[model samples]
Target: MSILMHVCTLVIKILVLPLQVAELLGLYQLYKRVFPVFIYNISFSYNSKMNDKKRELFRELLRFSPRAGPLRLLEVGCGSGANFQHYPSGCRITCTDPNPHFKEYLQKNMDKSDHLVYEKFVVAPGEDLRAVEDNSVDVVVCTLVLCSVSNAPKVIQEAKRVLRPGGAFFFLEHVVDEPSTWTYFFQHVFQPFMYYLGDGCEITRATWKHIEAAGFSDLKLLHFQAPLVFLIRPHISGYAVK
Candidate 1:
């Protein structure tokens, strides 16, 4: 890499490292209080590698999401607007995230026109969603968000409630893995730390079951593993028709 690039990378790492360290230590409230003040956008220094990884996973999701085109899309925790670029034409997007922190990033990276807007970046917890029209959305895309929500079941219900008939709910998430013994062990060990560091993400909750229980049909398991690591990629990416 060139000197300027190297220096920039070093600077970003320098800026983010403290928060990363704090997050891993289970000091989430502390991280939350300080993170917005320090680390505003996580993907500031986008490169081909990051873009390629994003495309691969995102493409994988689109391939699995049933009838993606011309759908009214709702992304619950859209961050940095990375997924906005890949939406098929005719798909109108409305993103609701709990962070107005990335408005500039979204404008620069994803907003191509007036049609797409981040209606409300930050919102009060689940009950606040009562305003979203019921059965109006054709698709609800949520990835890596359920892990952190205060109430996963409520969100799943909301996603289901807002989905149009024949609509699909797409998920690409890092969830608690199975093989009874390991799953149990992971629940016991990781729950406390993960809850704090990972945005109150629950490592043990059965999100699949929750989604299924919400009366959505056609559950498909795209992938899963016992331990979820970036390198290991123990992610579950799939969709269920609403």
Candidate 2:
């Protein structure tokens, strides 16, 4: 058993060496930029199989009216622009991300989204979205973002602040699992290292609690387990109207 543990530790050290070197050389930014493509390819591929079910449940929330001329959307993290193809026609999206490296990936996704208008990309954090005005956008979309923000409440407030009165905040996030579960135990034990491995992602964030406290009306949410994404298995997804 001791020999097996030593082997596991050695493997971990070997795996982490590249990450340590990237941080030391200030190439972590470049890593963060290129990393999402691989992750999104996996995640989106899995989720695409369920897109028909999702559309049946939440298509109305994502769709906009062409009669209204144009609808504005504010995507908080917008990493690698994974959600661009999901937007309705005539929607103009302003994507914001702290990592400037995502600019290239986002632009490429924008080019593919022929239905949605590519507004612009802002290099900013979700916690401070001063670039957007109050109650201006029709929707605020946050996917797999709140768990990584330093202050989730502040980011939620910012999402609320920028949304028009009747507009909604749509989110898809991974959260900590329920207590006493084996997955929860592993998630808790490995949480600290998740920041480094997942680019500041918190495996145990009570994101649903923060969203509930944001004072949004007509709140609706769903909690489910995703066993595929090893580090981020517990997930919550839904929308809240402001």
Estimated TM-score for each candidate:
0.66, 0.83
lDDT of each: 0.61, 0.79
For residues 123-218, write the lDDT of model 1, one tens digit per residue: 434424665789887778887678778888888888888887777788776665553454445453545545555556676666676776777777
Error of 1 at 173 (Å): 1.0
- Lowest lDDT sum, 10 consecutive residues, model 2, at 57-66
Q: Best TM-score goes to which candidate?
A: 2
lDDT of 2 at 64: 32
Clashing pairs in 2: none
Instruction: Point out the worst 10-residue segment of candidate 1 by lDDT.
Output: 225-234
